[model samples]
Target: MDILSTVELNDCPLCLGPGLLEEEGGHCVYATCLDCGCHTVPVNYRTEAEKLDAAQRVAHLWNVGKVISEGVGE
Candidate 1:
């Protein structure tokens, strides 16, 4: 299984700012740091359906993950 398959916030590595953290990619979580202008993506977990159910959350996770790994948000 790829890194994404085994990702979960509980076991994730990076710790970012508050406000609903989400997966940043294969092994990361990204969040917009209000404290800092730089978009921050802390190494985190897979976007779980149960944990993150809203469309905005899902999309945000995807975008954040993409940005962290691929350097662009979709």
Candidate 2:
């Protein structure tokens, strides 16, 4: 599997933790992380290409932290 599928396999890409609960939001699908006790929209990916794109973006965020861990970790 690619990175996007790999990432989604673990948990929510936003929080990057366990206990991710899926919530349908109109046109978008949302998943919440339970470990950090925070909510996130994660990367907005569509098709396989989109998923890959989003996965790459999310990987950057995961490494940089600033992209997602705002007010959560410093």
Candidate 3:
């Protein structure tokens, strides 16, 4: 499955505005908005359908607005 063919570059949930930078590394792919420091998890999906499902889950979680932060020491 091709990431570019499955994902929409413009409709990034993390971006929430516009101009998202899509990045792919190792076993996952995600989008990021540098201005907001917002990004999606590098979902480990083997198929295009799985990737879409994972993206939906991530978007839902982001929409819920329950952010969890951890300290370096912790």
How close to the true structure is residue 60 of candidate 3, measured as C-alpha lDDT? 49
Best lDDT goes to which candidate?
A: 3
Better lDDT candidate (1, 2) = 2
Per-residue alpha-carbon lDDT of candidate 3 for residues 1-74, written as tens digits (9 for 90 to 100): 54444444454344355434243654455555545655655556677667666665544444454222232322
Q: Which ranges of candidate 1 are over 4 A from the true structure?
A: 1-23, 33-36, 41-43, 50-74
Assess each prediction's global lDDT (C-alpha) against the native: 0.37, 0.46, 0.48
Of 1 and 3, the candidate ahead on lDDT is 3
The residue-by-residue lDDT of candidate 1 on 1-74, one tens digit each, is 33333333221112343233445444444444332233433543446443333334433553444323233444
Give me the displacement of residue 30 in model 3, in angstroms: 3.8
A best-first ranking of the candidates according to their TM-score comes to 3, 2, 1
Per-residue alpha-carbon lDDT of candidate 2 for residues 1-74, written as tens digits (9 for 90 to 100): 53434553344445566734232332233334566644444656456566555555554444443233344465
- CA RMSD, predictions in order: 11.5, 5.7, 5.3
